[model samples]
Target: MLRLFSVLIAAGLFLACLTGYVLENYTVQQRTYGGAGEHLRGAQPPYPAGGMDNIFWFLQVSDIHISRFVDPQRAPDFQKFCTETIDVIKPEIVLVTGDLTDAKERNRIGSRQYEIEWQTYQTILKKSKVLEKTKWIDIKGNHDTFNIPSLESVNNYYSSAIAHLCGHLHTLGGFMPVLHSRHERGTLELELADWMDNRRYRVLVFDHDLFSFVDLKFDKWPVVVITNPKSALYSSPAHEPLGKIKHSTHIRVLAFSPAQVTSVLIKIDGVTMGSAVHIKGPLHTLPWRAKDYSTGMHYIEVRAQDKAGRTTIIGHKFTMEEVRLLPFDIMASFILRSSHYMTLRVIFILVLLANILVIIAFRYLTRPQLKESPGFFALVNFSFHVFSKTNILYYPVLLFTCYIAVGPWFIGEIVDGHFGACFVFGVVVDGHFLEGSLTFLIGILQLTFFNIPLICYLCWCLLLRCRGAYFRSHIKYTGWSCSVPMHISMLGLLGWQVYACYLLQKTYGTAAFFLSPVRTWSVILALVLVYKAWNLNNSAIRTFKADMKNCPYS
Candidate 1:
């Protein structure tokens, strides 16, 4: 009855979580830039046409990773970037796309946000006066999310923004730009490289209703953005009306250079049109008939050369027709974003189902029989009787396993100056509870992988010391049948332990294997159990041989 109840509970939880995932991901549509009401109402009015008055420029800097413990110079360098580079560019807005601080400790394994790092970041902004010069927008990266219980928490020092920009992977490397499906819905997802090692930042220009951007290195000159007849690859009807692009008169460009304004050359289909004239601050305009190339797709290349002998070329594919992203691109982005959540859900469901099956199978195998047979039934009965006899050592080991399953197995500085528990249910940081599927999975793993094997080993040892003749006869009849499953379970548990140790070593260095009490104790207990099981196995084998010799059937 208890086993049946456990199976039902597992099934219930699985269904509940499955329903929750479906409702959260599918039924409830995520709000876009146009807001939830707009989405529910379907396509609303298209955005206004592009114009010179709508032109503006901004700076996007990501992965600042200011660290006071590891590299002390990081904070100073960031401050210098803000004061020297930001002041000169004088962008209307500065978008900081996360990783405002390196949350790791000196060892780099422990993840906890330090207040000093946040204070240093604030001090830099104030000292540089960048906040007063431009609209500073900052969002939390994965690093910033670490140890953060809630957005309202005092430990969360990030300045909230409308869109979330992450910088956990440092850089996509060769992947460069990974545009998302959200772009189709008028939300641009741009990821910038790290500023810690690579002094990279993006200069994004909003020309009319079009968006054009270019990634620039520190001190790199002639930041160019082609503004007119926007890139067809990025143009979206949700943000801008595609029908109005054909009425554009001149090909406009925004070029920012450290040196004196130089010549801006415009090329269409590899043919140079003419030199663009400087209209205003960083704005260059070249007259071009939009209808001339309105029939098919065309490429626009803008090459800007400064007096400092530095040249930069940027190209974009433009078309007067409607822009549609490839179907594969949209699918790929959706998959990449939701892959982790999907994987966790699948694994959680599988674990629950497997446990239910195992319980049902065990109950069926151990059920009372009207006529007992000397095959698998006798083996099951023999195993059950042996395990039913509990020993004094079992109590302590069972208590230890329970504690490990539920109690604080791993405790560290989860929040600034707040040491919290990282147990089976979840992590508790500064009195806030953060529970997830991963935490529950770990608890299930502890119960199945660690507790079950240890309990079985305890029962096996007790069985070897049993002095009843009937029990000895049953053991002889069962032979290796009962022992094989226990041995297999123990071997599987040991394998899991070794794999876990390797994972810990890989992630947090070799010191973590020994430093983590849960892992260290698990290894020690497994080794001890293996040694005891071996000795008991040999004793059982001797006793079986002796009983067989004395039996009349032999």
Candidate 2:
């Protein structure tokens, strides 16, 4: 029974490894959705009624962050460029989605030149005749609220409120917004009066710091513009609608933002077809196909909006029919063009080689022995030997190994010029960098290899448990109290990290990315240690019970 369970667990792990890692880039499935509700309305582009496919193009300008102080005259040049762009593309709508001006301040509280910066921004929009002629709408971004102390105030307020909720607040005032800072925190809403007749549209501002939707809602106001549906790579659709569309062809869009985008809107011909199918990630992916609609020529339009009411639109004319998949080389070439793909391939190769080396070494060193001993016992014994007082020299070695497993992230940050001596963990961090480096890959492999024996034993345990039987002779119990604190501390640290990363996500977009590998290793290492200690405790208890049988006065 135990053997059967082990086989099942091993099989499951193998399958997961194959599907999730090896074959991940082989093929991507097509996702399509039909006309949905209110969420779709804001995101989908306007449907085009029966018309011949013609060459029409549009322009998109994002993250303009126009600042007067940064470059005094660039604003005018920017306006001139916009004027030229209008003449060139003659876009249907000029969408300006947030960051109209740059605050040009970081960490220096209350020192922003908001008035001059915004004056420059407003002057550019007014001077640009193209903005007047073309339908252009502006959305508020973090920088646009330069004078507002929303981020600092809200962070303090929420932090205090959370502390109070957690039963740590003895004082009543702790629940209120902390006002110790020099500047007063304004209401985090930007009001646009009468852009529409007799109606006011309020653009709620945010710090763009959110890890979960629940945390977003806790802020009591939505902050951020809705973005277009995006792809895994945070890209818009790849296939140009210029040629005939095949049933197997995919229309992919990468629409995601730290500010949080809600829904995807898609349209076919003159009618709203459906919502864009979403694949959520740190960068979300949205995909669709023309086969979801009727065959023949159809106009495909997709729009994505973020929570802050900002919108982006894209459309193409497609001719849909049954067609074979694109050749593998063609797809591979496109995917390989991406730096991330190359990096992942390199890391995979490195890890695979490392594991192969470890396996070969273990096979060569170990002698085959016919035995019926539990693998868990051996793991516990080895761990005790390495960590016990008798092996005091190995303590520093263990610490060094753990540090190596975590050094990659810190080193990567230092190389990127984001490291500061004041960071709590003594690692450099600002949170906007999400991509990993070679060091990160090596660190993960090192950690994985260090714990490979325990990981294997855990897998074996699963197999044994699945078999529903095991030798009673292997059973043992002992005191695990001495090791409990270490295991608990590790687990507690992991939990705190997850929560901290979640809360700090908006401030540092890469918080989760930086912590992910560390958290993974911590989980694996802590769980193995805890399980080993448990077995040790059980065996000790059983040994004590056996020894009692020979008591002189039994």
Residues 328-388, model 1: lDDT tens digits: 2533344344555446555645554554444334434543332322344443344444433
Mark the regions of model 1 whose C-alpha exceeds 4 Å error after superposition: 1-52, 71-73, 112-116, 140-165, 172-186, 326-336, 351-425, 428-432, 437-520, 538-554
Across 381-490, the per-residue lDDT of candidate 2 in tens digits comes to 32232233212222333453445433442222231234421111234345433343444454445445444433344333322222231323222221245225533555
What TM-score does candidate 2 reach? 0.29
Model 2, position 229, has a per-residue lDDT of 17
Best by lDDT: 1
RMSD of each: 9.1, 21.2
Clashing pairs in 1: none
How close to the true structure is residue 13 of candidate 1, measured as C-alpha lDDT?
100
Query: In candidate 1, how many clashes are counted?
Result: 0
lDDT of residue 95 for candidate 2: 45
The best candidate in terms of TM-score: 1
